[model samples]
Target: MSRLELSPNFSDPDAFYAALTEAHRERSEADSERINARLILLLANHIGEQQVLEEALSIAAADSEQPR
Candidate 1:
């Protein structure tokens, strides 16, 4: 077999995140948004900021229960 190479198109972090969020929103399968929420939390932890992360978690939790 010949070697194959794959590359991600995300040139910037912000653009990558935006694309991720959009894709997450577009998913129709069950639990897709929940997966996205986990991803968001992971990214937030990576970025640091206990206060901001807490605030973001609060907002997300509040919105998760509402109609989309």
Candidate 2:
């Protein structure tokens, strides 16, 4: 079974966030969407596990559909 690592895994989360924001800076809405798509695909590819990826998709979808 795939373990959903619900923990702080990044050594420099702040720096990673800064870089992510920087990547979106000066980009149009469509451009930002494209970047996000590419990032997701790359990360999913890195994971390379259908079960884990499917679990992630389900969790994300469920969470997003919930009332905040």
Candidate 3:
């Protein structure tokens, strides 16, 4: 199985972030949450790699305040 790549993989991360924020603009909190869930499912499906997804989940679950 391939290892999860932690480094910057997107060609335009900031642009993507801007677009994502734009998508949530003016949305209600519930609507924004639904949008996020849908996006997550779509991306996870596109990834289509069990191991990589699990690793991503583990990393995401880590507390941001604590050292890695």
The candidate that achieves the highest TM-score relative to the unseen native structure: 2
The TM-score ranking, best first, is: 2, 3, 1
How do the residues 1-68 of candidate 1 rate in per-residue lDDT, one tens digit apiece?
Answer: 22212245456979878877777786776668678679877887685777766666677688899997
Per-residue lDDT tens digits for candidate 2, residues 1-68, read 77656688999999999999999999999999999999999999998889889888999999999987
Q: Residue by residue across 1-68, what tens digits does model 3's lDDT show?
A: 77888888999999999999999999999999999999999999988999999998888887565785
**Backbone clash total, candidate 3:** 0
Model 2 residue pairs with clashes: none
The top-ranked prediction according to lDDT is 2
* Model 3 / residue 20 / CA error / Å: 0.4
TM-score of each: 0.39, 0.92, 0.87
Model 2 residue runs over 4 Å out of place are none
Query: Which runs in model 3 stand beyond 4 Å of their true positions?
Result: 64-68
Relative to the true structure, candidate 1 reaches a TM of: 0.39
